[model samples]
Target: MMAKIKEFILLKIVIPIVDMMMGMKISYWYKKINKLNSLSRDKITEWQNRQFRDLIRFAYEHTVYYKEIIDKSGYSIDDFTSTDDICRLPVLTKEIIRQRYSDIVPDNITKIPHRKHSTGGSTGEPLRFIIDENTWGYVTAAKIHAWKTTGFHYGEPFLSFGSSSLFRVNKKNRLHDIYYKLRNAIALNGMNMEDSICRKYIEIARKKRVKYIYGYASSIYILASYVKKHNVKYKLNAVFTTSEVLTPEYRQVIEEAFDSKVMDCYGAHDGGITAFEIERGSYFVGYNTFCEVENPLEISTLYCSNLIDFAFPMLRYEVGDAVVMDNTANTHYNGQIIKKIEGRTGDIIRLKNGHTITNPGFTVVFKQFNVKAYRIKQLSESSLVVTLVVLPNFKKEEESKIIDTIKKYAGDDCEIRVEYIDQFEPLENGKRRFIMSK
Candidate 1:
C-alpha cells in the first residue's frame, strides 16, 4: 500500500516538476550555443584537434597509469605532434581497466562523484564502470545531435527501449518513469523481451505518439517483426539503432514496419560518442571525440580519446570493435573516416580446433541458406548447434549446402547439428545473441 501511494505521488507530482526544471536548463544552453549544423568539416576538425590535445595532456599529468607510461618512455605530451602519435602509446583494453581501475583515476581529483553504468554480459561477462556527471551530459548532447539529424526537434517526444535495475518500483523510480512517459518514451526493461512484453511496448508507443525510436538493434528488430506481423501502425520519423550491429535484414524489416529510414549510431559507455548520420545519408564523426582506426580489414579496432570526460582521462583508449573505413580523403586528418562497423572482437568465436571465425562469416553462410534468423552455439569441444528460424523458402538442398560450408570452415571432424525453430530465444537484456558458447 505504501509503494502504491509513493508511485501515485511521485508520478503525479514530483516527476513533472523535475522534468520542467531539466528542460529549461537544456533549453538555456541550446539558445546560447551557435548552431552546430552550420559548421563545415574543416571547422569541426579544427575544434576537435584543440580539445584532443588538452585531454591528452591532462591524462598524462594526472592519471598515474598514463603518467608512469609517459615518464618511463621519457616522452611528454608535446611529443604528440599529430593524432598518429597516439599509436605510439600502448592500447588500453577491458582487462587493463578492470585490473588497474584505481591507478587509472587521478589522485588530485580524488573522490570524483560518478554515475555507475553496467554492460550486459553479451560477451559472457558483464562489466560495471563509472563516468562523471559531465561525461553523462556529453552523451546526452550526442543523442541530441543524432536526433536532430533524424528530424527530431528539441524537447520532442521519442521512445527509447532501454533498461533499468530499479525493480520493486519505489517513489524515485516511479517519478523517473513518469518523466519518461511525459517526454514520449517508455523504458521497457531490457531484461525482458517475451512476446507479451513486446506487445506492451507497441501499445505504449501507439498511445504516446512517439516520433523517433532508439535502442539496441537486436531488440528494435524483434519489435519491428512484431509490428509487421501484427500490422501495427505507429507514425515514426526515423529509427536509430545502436549498441549492437545492425544487419541488413534487420534494417529492412524495421524500415518497412516503422515506415521510416533506419540510421545507425555507434558509441561506448566510456565517454566517446564519435559517429552519427548527417543530413546527407553519410555518417559524420562527432566533433567531441578524436577517433582513429587502428586496423581495418577482417577486423577493425577503434582508438579514441574523449574530450569531455576530463574526470576519468581515457587517452587513446582502445574500444574493441571492428569497422570498415571509407576511401574518402580526410584533408584535415590523415586517415579515412569509418564507413561501416562490423561487430566486436567478442562477437567472434574461436573453434577448439584453432580456427577463428567472425560473425560475418556466419552471416555469409546463413544468407546463402536463406535462414530467417540463426544462432550458432558451441556445444562442446567438437560440436556446434546451429539454431535457425527457417524461412518459408528454405529447402533441403539449401541445408546440405550450409552443412558443407560449415564443415569446410570448422573442419571435417566437428559435429554440426541443425535445429529449426519458429523464433530465436531472447537474452535477458532483450538482445538476441547470434552466437553463443556453452
Candidate 2:
C-alpha cells in the first residue's frame, strides 16, 4: 500500500512540482512522448524531418563552430531536407569538441540557463559540455518510456550499479542516500565487485524485494556469475544493461540467475544517441535522436544529432562506437533500428600475486585530470605503460598522481611508466581500446 502511494505521489505530485521548481518541461515531454508512441510511421517520419531541419538551421545560425563549417561545406542549412543530408556536414569528433569548445556553445548561452556536465573517461576522451533543462527533460522522459516497455515503473524498488566515484556510500553525502531512499532504489559501487561485495548486494536485493536491476554489463555479469555459482534465486521483472556490450554469455547467465529477461540499452549521453532493445537483436531508436552510420550496410562508426538540444549543438557528432544499422527499417518509430552495436568491452589485468585490476578503476582516477585521451598497455605481468594525451592545462605534477592511482590498483611494486602523446592511432575496428594486454 505504501509503495503504491509513493508511486502515485512520484508520478503525480512530486514530479510536476519538481519540474515547475526547476523550470524543466518533463511533464510537457511526457505528453509529447505519449502522443508520439501512438503515431503512424509516416507521421513519425514527418516529425523527425521537421526536427532535423530545425536543428541544422538552429546550429548553423547560433553556433560559431557549425556556422563556419556549414559555410565551408558549400551547403546552406536550407539544403538539409532529410536526416540523410547531414552527411554533407563534417563529422564532429572529440578532438574538435575539445579544441573548439567555446565556438560550439550558442551565442546566447548566457541568456539560457544550463547545467554543465562531463562524460566518463571510458572512451579515453572525457568531454565537458552544457545541457539545458529542456534537453534534460526530454532525456528523462525518453529513459522512463524506454524502461516502461520492459514493465519497469518509476519509483519502484530496484538496484542500480554505477561508478564508485559518483555513488559512494560514505557519510560525506547524506543527500545522495536520502535521494535514493526516496526513489526506492539503491546505488551500488560498480568499480569494485569482489565476491563479498556481490554477496552483500545479492542479499540486499532479496531483502528489498527488488523487481528490476539496471547497471553496467560487466558488473551485472560478475554479480550474476556469483549468483549462479551459489544457486541463489531471484524473480525480477527484467534486467537492463548498458554502457558496455551485453555478450551472449552475460545475458544467459543474468537471465537464469534472476529469472527475468535482459533488455539492453545503448546511449551516448554526450552525443545524445539513445536506443533500447525491442526485440532480441533489433533496437528501437528513440524519436528524439537522429542516428547515422558512416557506412550503413557494414559495421561502421556511429554519428548522431540531438533534435531537441540546441544549447550546445552536437551536429553529426561521432559517438565513438561501432554499429551496423538495419537497412531493412522496421516500419515502427521512424523506421530506425540498430541491428547490432559493438559497445565497449572491459579488459582485466591479472598480476602475478593474483590481484586483478580493471579498466573502470583507472577510468575513475583519470576523470579528475584534463586528459583528452589515454591508453593502458600491459607489456608483461609486472610492467605497465600508460600513454596519455592531455590538454594544455594538464600539469607535470599530475603525472605523479596518475602513477599513484595506478599503483593503488596494480600494487606498489609493479613497474609503471607514463608517456605523453599528442593522440592515439585508431584500431582497425575504428574504436579505441582503453586497456590492452600484450
The lDDT, on a scale of 0 to 1, for candidate 1 is 0.61
Tens-digit per-residue lDDT, 1-438, candidate 1: 543454445434653465354332233223212354455666665666676677678778778888887777767778865565667678776667777877777776645545555443223223445565556545555566567656675445566654432134344455456554444455554332445656888777777667688876766877787788888877688988766677778888998998997888777776354576543234566555667675555345667776657667776776656566665654433322567765432243456775433342343345445566677778887788887777688887887777777776567777899888786555543346666655
Q: Rate the local accuracy (lDDT) of all candidates.
A: 0.61, 0.78
TM-score of 1: 0.66
Worst 10 residues of 2 by lDDT: 171-180
lDDT of 2 at 374: 87
TM-score winner: 2
Off by over 4 Å in 2: 1-4, 120-123, 164-180, 329-335, 350-357, 377-387, 391-400, 403-423
